[model samples]
Target chain A: MKRLSEERTKLVFEKLTKYLGDNLKVLIDRPDGTYCFRERKDRVYYVSEKILSLASTVGSDHLVSLGTCFGKFTKSGKFRLHITALNYLAPHAQYKIWVKPSAEQQFLYGHHIAKSGLGRITENTPQYQGIVVFSMNDLPLGFGVTSKSTADCKHADPMSTICFHQADIGEYIRSEDTLL
Target chain B: MDVVNAILEKNVNSNKSISVHKDLELEIDEGTLLASDYNVFDKENLRSSQDTYLKNLTRDNVQVLINKIWMLQTERVDEAIVGILPKPVFVLPRARSVPKPKPLTKWQQFAKEKGITSKKKNKSKVTWDEELEKWIPKYGYKKAKADEQKEWLVEVNDPTKFTNGEDPFTASKTAKREKQAKNELQRLRNLAKAKNVKLPRVGIPSTEHFRDARQLAAATTIARASTASVGKFQSRLPKEKDAKDIASHVPGIKKKRKEAPLSVVQEKQRNKKLAESILRSKSTILHVDAPVPSTKSAKSSNSGGKKKSSKKEGKGAKKPKGGKGKRDLRSKVGGRKRR
Candidate 1:
């Protein structure tokens, strides 16, 4: 495993802050253990020192995976967070949207959330902001970027899309082979 | 009391290395020695009267130790009877690792295999000299020997060999030397055998002969790639048969693609610093690129640097603490007012 370069770290940090915001500090300066971001095979893993040191014993090429794959760098060199990071991101999400029961299935099927399905949205959530989508019962089902701001959602039509679909929990089954 | 009458109190801070102390000071030094007790006391048993309990325990233990020592067989030596101490009672914990068996020298290994026991040196430093008829050192200065002698002149039997008038003393001393050549040869042999550092071969010479295995491999690989046919048709060259060494002076080749270095520490600090700077810029759009922080603009408006710093602190105080806590309270009050 290797550390992210300054330029690469900047890209990863900027994307991470979009979802976690101020809670990003908890990941780096964790009390439970020292954690860091390591890049292996173009994928960044949020690994603790103990796990990383142990994993380092295995040859980089032969080692299949590392501790908690956070995201990967696209072919165009842009950083994208994967669905596997939902467990960590959900707890620290700055802006969140709770989906209605009727639309939870549709969201799981990888469809953009509509205004009618938006059970509740955090106030002042800016447009294009990264947000975690949860069910009305508080189960985090998926996450995506917002299409419209909180203020604009009130005047918009019920059928108009409010949240753009990026990834959902269903990917665990659909893309299980390629997740890591 | 007699020294106190003649003492000068003003000279207390004198810089002399040795100083005389009062009788009371010596007593205090000896009193602190009792703090290092070898016996253990059950703190709970002696909870009320520790000092008296410790005193009794120490006295009884010392008496038992003395009785044990006196029971041992005594020996008279140096005009006194002394008890022969037995093996220690307490086994202290080891403060260091087990001593490793030393690597055997060649002679020791040979002797062990041949079942040749070594003979101890004679304890006497002096040996009887036949020529001098007196005792002389066994090894050092002025040792008695029949062949090696300190004489004024040397008589050479072969006059033809000494026609060039060479120094016969050095020649005779070398001949008299015992195992000098054998010792040097064994030392070099041990050095080469330990790591198999190949000795320079006969017939040809090059600096590449001394290079390590890794460097030699890389150099050979580099040489093969640089040739006309790319070393495909080239026959395997004999190691002993020296060929033209290409890149013999070059140490190593530079890597084309450098991997991202492994320093989790630097990455952690760098990522944190970048994120903090980004977070700060998000709320307050300060001109980071602006030279000297627009205290220049403040300097134009204000007269002194002191006022500028105070004004900057005032600006900081005016900003809300956070986006959620205090801002939510302020927004709630504003919403109520608008209603």
Candidate 2:
């Protein structure tokens, strides 16, 4: 089990701060250099030695194991933000589209929100930009991309579609067997 | 025990004669005492004959039979106890083993050491900023860069704050404007000079040079005079009136002879009769037995027939003459060649 060096953690933290902004803090308490991350052959990030130790101590086996590749680390290596990491980070996301109650089930089922399903979105959010989508109760549903800007939406037809769902917990559950 | 004794005494006193009856009656009457009787009376005899009768039964079989009997007794006791006691509700135990963890690599180990866990918490501890009215991180609230914040702000111009100010580059702008105007004026003057400078005529001389305005006026007068003469000639020539007009004008021409104005019913009847006559004529032509009238006779018959029939013959005659004329010309040319 390898641990990330202080230098590597700083590098990752800096990149995360730039990419995710305030959302980075939700993922890490602080860049204390105690956390360990494994880089897979496909460039995905995963919790390795530290999580294994935690698992042994906690006596629990269920754990999130994969993180998505976020931004370029070097010309060759890339930094990835884990999908599970987004669970903590979603609340801190600056841009968000709050989905309607009627669209909650469809959103969890990994269907993109139709224009009408866009109940409330962060003001001044740009079009084609990545945004977090939440349910009416403010439970983060998943990540999505805005199809139209807030200004475009003001004059847009009510029936026009708006956001595209990227990933969700429901998709993870449905694909758990295949993921393994 | 008392019931068994009473039954035994009754059986013994009632049946004293037959020994078989007495034995059978005793066996039947003493149900509780049967096992004791087997143990006490039949034990020695059964032991002696055990080799012969119990050859098929194993120790296991005997033990199983004893256990089955014991179980039945216990089940009866349990049923009685259950009838008196309250029913117990059973619950399944919680699963002891957790789900299997996904395999990790070296880098993940490093990441995990830095307080990273594989199990990401679904609920975020990030607090909502009341002032900002948005969710914020637990620690180290990162305010967006001023430039980024500016980018996110909707662009709006304050019309009320707009002030009419003096032109900042009045001298340069006015000089440039005057220069552009001078250049435009120069271009216009050059275009006028180019237009005024006459170039020698190229290509063939125009025929229009032959006629001056006076010649044109004379030509117009000649054309007018010719048109007037032509109109006078046209007026002097007799104009052929329509047959309906001729009939109306000439007293001798009967209105009935000229087509009378027919009502819809009359027109339909006339059309039907005309169709019947046409059908009769077509049938006559189609039938081999019906003689085809000679050309002269056909013409005379057409003239004698109704005006409609004469009109139909006239149309038919014109079509054949066109073809016949060419044939006649060919024949005449052939005759001349023969001569």
Candidate 3:
């Protein structure tokens, strides 16, 4: 509901920059309505300025949720983007992977993506880069960090992890009832 | 209303009237108003019911304040009469302590050490100026006895030994200039002494080497504490000579830091507020031991939105619709690969 402080902004921006890269600027400063990141209950919400003002009118005790839940800070203060942030991350994501239909359910169930499940990967994708996982039809499902670069993937073991699951659409079904 | 009086009479059953304070200790400002009551508490009545006792006390104090305001002189302005409030009678604690006596100057310190007391040199401030034909201040504005301003002619006691037109006027001007320059230097030295800095013997400012060494030491210390990384993967070069005396001569980089643009501070404050707001919204009860790596246990914070409801299906975690058979099947995460 309020603006973020310098220390918290550093933490959130570092995590967000991992996935969005230079495009993180575009996500924060959009051509649409002005958007802001607000932290409530250790969770960061990316809401438009208008929604933030409205949400602020409600007392903190009664106010539950507003805008999109991007992620939450762990008790130790590390930021973790939730599955809800996939919408914002997908378009601006620098690295990407398409999953075969057979591996879609496994990703949704929070299992790491096996090399065989990777249908396609972006050219020259670097190892451990944050990437969006999509269906073969180009539907954004979840996001994760690439386990190996595109060149390494060609010779990687078929059963080895290609992408480590960070968040997925399944979370929209779990613990996300209050998410706007 | 008379209801309070009626209540007092009805509740008290005894004849003793409520004893209240005689003075109204009210302090009103541009918008803030404060009232302090010095009356003794009715402990007996408070033990039975605090509500009535405090209420009665407030009523009496308010009534006195109203009477005091009405007693003031009123002025007619617009539609209503307004009485200007007089200065408050109560003595208030000073907001700031009387500034401690200014740091002692060099002369004062010398006098103190020697047990010397100052005595006035002259009582009379004026002297007769023969040329001006009137009394003038010995040292102040418009002093007519200054040698440069007064000297008009010179007398030669021995005509052979003196130049005919020679006079003291020009010599006096140079003397005055030199005296003023000396005072200017002393003034700076006095100021430095008050600030607890020792100037070099030759000048009011510290020497070049002293200054450069102080700056180097501060820079070295700041650079070391500023970043925690061991220069990351790279090895550190030979350490620069530590400037030890800099701490005694100079304060920390506090003044340099304050010079940062105001926008930086505002941005920092905004981020801080956002962090606080996020912390405020999180449910505190559910926070337990750090599960760390996987933080995905999201229970609907709205109390009613319990996890694993049988009536819900696999539509999404937000609205679960599953059969009764999977109710207690185990695992916090839904369909998580559990063999």
The best candidate in terms of TM-score: 1
Give per-residue CA lDDT, model 2, range B1-339, as digits (tens).
999999999998766332121122121111121211122334665678887445423332344333333433233474563122223233336579776664444446568789776687686767676756667666444543322343353323434432235332453357669988987865655555546754444576455643665544443333333553432333321553224433343333336543455533443344334434444554343242123234334323322332231122111111112112223433422111121
**Candidate 2: tens digits of C-alpha lDDT, residues A28-65:** 43353332343333333434334545554542244334
For model 3 the local lDDT of residue A10 reads 68
Per-residue lDDT of B1-339 in model 1, one digit per residue for the tens?
757744654356343323232233221112122112344457875998888877766555444445445677799999999877655544457899999876566777889999998586657878786765677777767663523553446776568545346677766666557467877877886777566677656665366574665556655666655666555554556672213343354334323465566466766677778889766654332122113323334323222222221221111112211122223443422111121
Per-residue alpha-carbon lDDT of candidate 3 for residues A4-82, written as tens digits (9 for 90 to 100) = 5557776787666557666666756567866777778888888887787788789998987889888777766667677
Instruction: Give per-residue lDDT, candidate 3, residue B288.
Output: 26
- Which residues of candidate 3, in runs, are more than 4 Å off? A177-180, B1-339
Better of 1 and 2 by TM-score: 1
Residue-level error in angstroms, candidate 2, position B178? 90
Q: How does model 2 score by TM-score?
A: 0.27
Superposition error at B224 for model 2 (Å): 99
Better of 2 and 3 by TM-score: 3
Rank order (by lDDT, best first):
1, 3, 2
User: Whose DockQ is greatest here?
Assistant: 1
Kindly report which residue stretches of model 2 are placed more than 4 angstroms away from their true locations once superposed. A1-19, A25-33, A41-82, A178-180, B1-339
Which residue window of length 10 is worst by lDDT in model 3 chain B?
B294-303
Cα error, residue B295 of model 2, in Å, equals 92
Candidate 3 per-residue lDDT over residues B92-157, each given as its tens digit = 689998999987667788899998885866668887988877787888677634744665664544
Better of 1 and 3 by lDDT: 1
